[model samples]
Target chain A: MKFPFTSEQLTKLHARIETPALIVWQPNLEKNIADMQALANRFDAALRPHTKTHKSPLFAQWQLNAGAKGITVAKLSEAEVMAAHGIDDIFIANQITQVQKLKRLRKLHERIHLTVGLDNPRQIDLLRPFFKDASTPLNVRIEIDSGLKRCGVTVGNDLVELAKAVARQPFLRLDGIFTHAGHVYAARSAAQVEAIGKQEGALMAGAKTLLQKNGLRIATVSVGSTPTVPFSVRNPAVNEVRPGNYVFYDAMQIALHAAAPEQVSLFVLSTVVAHPVAGRLVIDAGSKALHTDGAGVTGHFGLPVNIKGKVVRLSEEHGVLELPEESTLRLGDPVLLVPNHACAVANLFDVYYLINEALQIKTVPVEARGKSQ
Target chain B: MKFPFTSEQLTKLHARIETPALIVWQPNLEKNIADMQALANRFDAALRPHTKTHKSPLFAQWQLNAGAKGITVAKLSEAEVMAAHGIDDIFIANQITQVQKLKRLRKLHERIHLTVGLDNPRQIDLLRPFFKDASTPLNVRIEIDSGLKRCGVTVGNDLVELAKAVARQPFLRLDGIFTHAGHVYAARSAAQVEAIGKQEGALMAGAKTLLQKNGLRIATVSVGSTPTVPFSVRNPAVNEVRPGNYVFYDAMQIALHAAAPEQVSLFVLSTVVAHPVAGRLVIDAGSKALHTDGAGVTGHFGLPVNIKGKVVRLSEEHGVLELPEESTLRLGDPVLLVPNHACAVANLFDVYYLINEALQIKTVPVEARGKSQ
Candidate 1:
């Protein structure tokens, strides 16, 4: 009861598995992984999850073992971590720059079928040398900037031009054109997200067509995020979907109708440390645990869900509660908190508690917790 | 350069530090610590740094060795971690709650002197049992809500009544009053923050006088926050100042003019991992490395400066640089990004590199990184 693990097991591994440790609920994670696997199978599309969510090689293995075709990583470091864990197929979904990274890519190319996403022609030229010596060459994809306005080349000839350049890279292989309908996150409703997903699929398909008409062979069209997966996975043009948070959805994901609340597998288990003042109760967990990720503008500071019994208000280090004017919260009560955004919160710690529906606990390593490089 | 420790060192020890690690600039931290030490010396007031910024036991040891009277913890878990690291004098700056946490607090009490901040009568009742057997009761300070609107009881007769209630509890000791003018964080200018600091000091002093008039001994009047410290330190009525971020000022703190950019001791060191496309470069660091704690209205993303020597948009693990219309980023470039908020970013990492001013690296443990209890 004192630590996350059972007292019997805790005593045996007391020194290594320290308290203030990130406890993983394995059963919950297994359920989350199974649910996502079911969705990908139902849609008949590859679930190449973006590993940035949990950044765990173990979780990536779980996903692949659960029938995912490949794993998506946002950084080369994440790919490296995954590679070390024996994940051979990696999709570096973000733009890659710098010769150092290219060298690493070149090395990885020798070991795995490596694909990098790009939004510009210069990147194709930059990657030429890394692939020049390789027999299979590097796989490249042109990323289209669909309404998010964050990255990627905007629609039309600009995207087409980028794609052509990718095809022209002497040692690079132009596999496909991809776009993440990131704006789907701001969807007003689930209906809007689905509509946005359709538009996103069309946009990628349109870009692929433009490239094909210009005499380029586009092998795949990919578009997906946890929010858009439910809407985009069934699209015929899209061969793969990368929805990371689906494995452990959070409150914002639920609000977006990405998953039902019960489907959320991750939570912050906190203890009430102090009730120094009435109307304000402080919990042992703070921003360090719950994180300052304001996924959606909920009136409360964090996503407050009824976990077992307590209604908690998350503060920086203390989840404050405006105790009922009549009721009181004593010190040492444990409360469960579901965060607003699972992805960001998941990245905050080195491990997580894999708890079952019955609340049985298991520890799992967040193998990719710090794989930002 | 590949591992946090040097190749020679890592080879010698066979210890693998996590990669894409959050490396702290150590000599820079020492300078920052010394500067704050000088500040406290100049003002002749005790410096009790809030440990929420760099929750590292190693750093806490450095601060205490350099002459911080005590460590100020925002939560009980942090206090517990610091205590584990031999930091005996601690002040829980926030209210405490949860029964399990109280038990931990009781366990901690057997070892160190603790002062907990409180604002209401019910909190007094909760602490009575813990203090019942004490020869010298645990100290409690009433927190005055001064415009931050986060926590603390608003100053006035209610505060006086609360202090009186504490006086009535035989097991509780009314230490004094404290207020954190967090509103100063949004100050447009130093003059504004200074003025706010004056108002905060007046409120703390006024509350103390009111408590004293009502037969409660006013032992300490503390008013502090990095933004208010420069001004509030001059207030004679304020016996203590708790400014944690000053030890490693951040971009937001610098923007608020609380500290100059040079005073910023901490920064996230990231590598240019990929240049997938021109006009868009990705760094190994993103929301996970430099947390997405943006300056809400100021639009500061808090990235360590220059991703490929240019500003970039951050995705989870990759920072997407939107280069100037004609800019070019080559592969393998290293960039420095000063996060907008250092505290949250620091909290995300398990260990950090301590680099000298010349950028020579010294490794240190972020011992308290995941101490969320």
Candidate 2:
């Protein structure tokens, strides 16, 4: 495999950077962040970039330092990591239940300006015992189902009831309405993404008005996900966008027409270990690195831009590349690939080798990786 | 959602056991080890259980202690972790090339009885320089394609050519021949798995005999992959079988009919965080926890046993479950799921909470996880 940077740039990197490594192209990553922040600014939305994508406290801090309002995490473990790193404004965009998890949440909430997403009264009831005596009220955004059938209330009586239930708890603050337009990732074109985004902003805005009319105040109406960001933020209804993958747009984003090749930031650096046949090569990076998630748009596992070949398939530890005929690639050649999903790939790695705009390399442990809880 | 264990069993477990966890049923795991060991004993085939399934040094030591001849790993990083844990014999059942990696192989070889898999001559030349003045020769097994056309030689003249080239290097020892019957996972029944196994054993035996007659001495005729272990290990001609997932059979094995549900040893312990609507539930475990790969055999992502539901789909952190009608499951209810592929799921977690037969909880870090390099 070749160094993604120039020979001179490679010379500046600390020796011993190897293949099957997650290399975060910081220049591109910073640009992606700047561009996303600009998008949020254009639409007068507060940017709370999701830390779930990078799962790195350092990266999240970079976004926060760059004017992001806060960060969104999917798990309590992730929020714990961010909070440990002094990221005070943390929103867990997932339900938290279980007596044990609620205790942890209550404790963490006491430390930060924590806002959790809640859809059902059962979760609220579970947290009641812990929150009942909480000195600081736990804030919650009503997770409403916009279009994605994955989670959230369906913006009706259920939404109204949950909002009221959350409001009923003296220790719980009914903050705002939140919805994730995840279905936008499945959209075929940019126009479709825009349509889904419009629906999302309208849905969240509608939920806010509905809840407010019912005497529950809503503060932050948040819409996020990389694919829906550009479109959703454009709508007048959204005030906050929480696009995590924008920190590292992957092949999935490119396939969805949500990102350009130049904007794709993270790459799985691999080394061709075997040239089993003339044109077919096997790289050390496999499903564990590139991940097995479908390339949402391209149908390929990953795209190796430097080589004129495609990562066709992946076993647990072997990436099979069907190279172009008459290719000059050989054994030990460094191949770089943009993965299908940046979030999944990030979770698969324990640490990421950060390559600066100047291509100097350093390593940072993926602090919240495998923090799925 | 329901727990895999009975109420009595759950009562005996550690009070703080959490969700979205990788729990190793140590009793079942030990039993699986004994059963597979019995299979190896029946035919006098030495067991070289692949460590790729667990990627845990602690687990690999258990296999080695259970009378495994050696341990097989998928990557050098995995081998390094195993070797660090005092596993002297390691067979990296994958090709290794590249100047940097070859140097690492040479260095690691100096410490252990390491054997790497190779298919071509260029790899030999690359190692030739490093091993030219080595204290101990680098042992290599020729990898032949049994059925999985992913790697290895075609097993005729190509095998002979590669073997002869490996032997030509004073630093390389063409010790054994290896093949992985990964396609056995696609078998429709135990009989189909046997057929694939028969083909694999016959092919490896045939290749060994052909190579010996062609003037190269060969030892260690190895075959592996958990699905073919039962049938393939029965072949007396095979000396070493490296099936790793037998330590923890999952839904994929159950669908292959290679394992019974009672034989399943690992479970992704999760919690029903959201009952989005009636009968439908969302678990805190998503693709990052349960993963998104189909069961390869049944097209199912994961099967939650005591709970009558399929983990229908997964986002990054939300597993959408389609529960049975009139189910009494609620928020905070524990769910235990047998993943489609245990190996993939294991890699997704930082540690496995070992629940012994007595139902005590202890954590063992997945030592080699994310060691993709």
Q: What is the C-alpha lDDT profile of model 1 across A1-373, one tens digit per residue?
A: 0123353443333223333334455665788788778887897777888888887887888889999999888877778888997889999987766555677888888998788887767666667777777888788877877777665777677776777766666687888877788777677788998898888877776777777888888887888688887667676777778888877777677677777766666666655554545565555555666665554433344443432233344434555555556333355444455677677777777676555545555667777765565
Off by over 4 Å in 2: A1-15, B1-4, B11-15
Q: Where is model 1 more than 4 Å wrong at Cα? A: A1-32, A103-114, A124-136, A154-173, A271-286, A295-300, A307-315, A318-335, B1-31, B124-139, B154-175, B269-284, B303-313, B320-332
Output the worst ten-in-a-row residue range by lDDT, candidate 1 chain B. B10-19
lDDT of 2 by residue, B183-235 (tens): 77667887888799888988988998999999999988999988877777766
Weakest ten-residue segment in model 2 chain A by summed lDDT: A7-16
**Chain B TM-score, structure 2:** 0.96
| Model 1: per-residue Cα lDDT at residue B340 | 74
lDDT tens digits, residue span A2-65, model 2: 3347644433331356778888888888888888888888889999989999999999988987
Interface Cα RMSD for all candidates?
5.8, 1.5
Model 1: how far residue B268 lies from native, Å: 3.4
RMSD of 2: 2.1
What C-alpha lDDT values do all the predictions have? 0.69, 0.84
Model 1 lDDT at residue A195: 91
